[model samples]
Target: MIRVVLTDIEGTTSSLSFVHDVLFPYAEEHIGEFIKNGFSDNPEIQEQLEAVAEESGVSANDLDGLIEVLQTWIREDRKETPLKMLQGMLWEQGYQSGAFRGHVYSDAAEALRSWHDRGLRLYVYSSGSVKAQKLIFGHSECGDLTPYFSGYFDTRVGLKRDPESYRNILDQIGVAPDTVLFLSDVEAELEAAETVGMRTALLVREGPLPETSRPVMRDFDEVDALLRKR
Candidate 1:
């Protein structure tokens, strides 16, 4: 039986355009100023900046240089932890300002509620920071669907492509790997979850299916049906 459902945010529960067009641009536009106007003085922001400095071999005190590196990472959509953390902080400001509500697909919104009601635990595992995950769901179009989730996982556990990450999630959730179902748009992420003995499903929103052995799901209803059969 599938006791837990681990889902990816972008391309799984939300649209890719929302991330690329909306979220990324907002972060890119505001990040330089956000760092310049003394927000960098916050201890947490300072810590992440230090991390970025260490990774990029730049000096932490060189704020302008660090901001330039961050802008490059944002443009490339790199999955660096510090970049994600900074993005999350910027997104929090966006969400609070009513700039945009997080986009959750209608199908995902409905199915997630149904699954939560059915006594299945739902969790989110995304490359985005855990705070970002909560912010998205907490301000979702579905109206604060954050209550549906049992937990959230971010790169802090490990990269989603690493099998050990899924293993760590299983351990943290206190569920057998076989009893967890992992859903993602990326085949590599699904493969990693499968390698850790978790059941996996691919969310193919469009285009030709990738060359993968995992079952492809067009929507959450299909996933719900599969769970019912199990």
Candidate 2:
């Protein structure tokens, strides 16, 4: 029944600890050095640095102070665009250097492949920057799952918890809400998508099921079974 599958990253297709304990820390540790070393030549980083200065009121010349602000944002889990962009660059380096491989659950990798083979259009919707999203799937331990996905959406579209964001994604994807299945571990995000009439599934990869009317899936295997029934 569903033609499109939209998934969240952290706790949905990937483990939460992989993001929190691994990716986030790697970015935090390297952001300053990355900025210091590249600030002179990379216009892309320069632009984001300008954004950082404007948003935080830090002096544009205060590169060291800006680095400190970025480190703070990392610790606070702030969803600043500049922070996400810079982190993506650092992660790209990490991925290319083999410092870390993106984490995707075995079940998720298997099921996503099956869905793609069956002509279900797969997509990613995460708070992470689009670059970061691509880095993870494109350099995954499953050996580059990017081919399975058609598009990606990040906070640039809107906050995940906002219904309008789903509306925007639906508008861009040119799909009816009912024909698209949105999967996420976060109840708020699922509920937001549900508000816009999108099919919603809760991914409880670990722990007991929460109280919700939406279908609760233990893993992508369960999602695959659900797809067959539909």
Candidate 3:
């Protein structure tokens, strides 16, 4: 029996346009200013800047250079940890300012609540920072869905496409791999989870379903029904 449900955010429980069109643009527009306005004194920002410096082989004191590199990563949609952390910080500001509420699918929100009430341990595994993941769900259209999650995992654990990352998550969650179900819109991510012996379901919200051995669902309701039958 599946005891845990690990879900992706973008394109899984939420809309991809919100990430690409809304969040990314807001971050790209504000990041340079955010860094310049003395927010760098914040320890979290300092640590992420140090990480950026270490990863990019640049001087941490060169604030302009760091900003340039970060803007480039934002434009490229690079999944670097520092970039994700910075984006998360900016998103926190956006969420607080009411620029937009996180867009979760209606079906996903309903099914998530139902599953949580039914004694399933729900978790989120996304490329976004854990803080950002919480911000999105906490300020969601459905309102404060954060309490439904048992835990959150980000790229800090490891890349989603790396099987070792799923193993690491399984270790952290303290569950047998087969007792956890990984749900993602990305084929490679699902395959990586499967490589670690976890069950997987591909969320095909648009276009034709890909040719793959994994089970496919258009929404979480289908997933819940399918799981019940198993």
Candidate 4:
């Protein structure tokens, strides 16, 4: 019955090390410079700068203070919209400059192609901004995967841990919740998706699997198996 596959990016389709080790560090390294020089080039940069100022209770004129605050947010991996937007902008630079290609698992890329070929719609829902999500897939290690996805959702819709977010996605997709399979590495996210009546799967790639009542999948191949049963 599943017609749409809604997936998380960081730990589901890609490795956690890539996010925590490579992307975060790259963003932390370049964000300050990006903010300082980016405002004049793109109005969106200025907009996010103002947003960072407003959210952090810092003065708009205080660029250094804002940059410091943003770096801190990067270190903490805080899922704030302003931080995510800024990070996305910085990541776009990294991706385009050939600093690093986005790391997507081989299984994920193959399954995604297989799923799309099977006529199932694919979508991405991640804490990263929509722009960031696209850049990752667009310049992925497996070449461009952006063409495989039908749509993308970021924190702008809502946090993944909120059931209303799943409801919002379900509403936008215009499908019954049960017909969408939500894939994520976080148990809370899966629980939230289930709260909205969506089919949920736990994607655990490394470390010990959490004690989840929901079906746990090693990789996208297992997800293939799960989807076939329905």
Colliding residue pairs in candidate 3: none
Model 3 regions more than 4 Å off: none
What is candidate 4's lDDT per residue for 89-177, written digit by digit as tens? 88988888999999999999999999999999999999999999999899999999999999999988899899999989988999999
Clashing pairs in 2: none
* Candidate 1 segments whose C-alpha is farther than 4 A from its true place: none
Decide which is better by lDDT, 1 or 2. 2
Tens digits of lDDT, candidate 3, 1-230: 99999999999999999999999999999998987884546888888989999999889999989988998898898999999998998899999999988989989999899999999999999999998999999999999999899999999999999999999999999999999999999999998999989999999998987878789999998999977976
Against the correct fold, how does model 1 do in TM-score? 0.97
- Candidate 2: lDDT over CA atoms? 0.93
Q: Residue 93 in candidate 1 has what lDDT?
A: 94
At residue 110, what lDDT does model 3 achieve? 92
What does candidate 4 score on TM? 0.98
TM-score versus the correct structure, for each prediction = 0.97, 0.98, 0.97, 0.98
Model 2 segments more than 4 A misplaced: none
**Model 4, C-alpha of 87: deviation from truth (Å):** 1.2
> Taking the tens digit of each residue's C-alpha lDDT, what string does model 1 give over 33-110?
887775546888888899999999999889989999999999999999999998999899999999999999999999
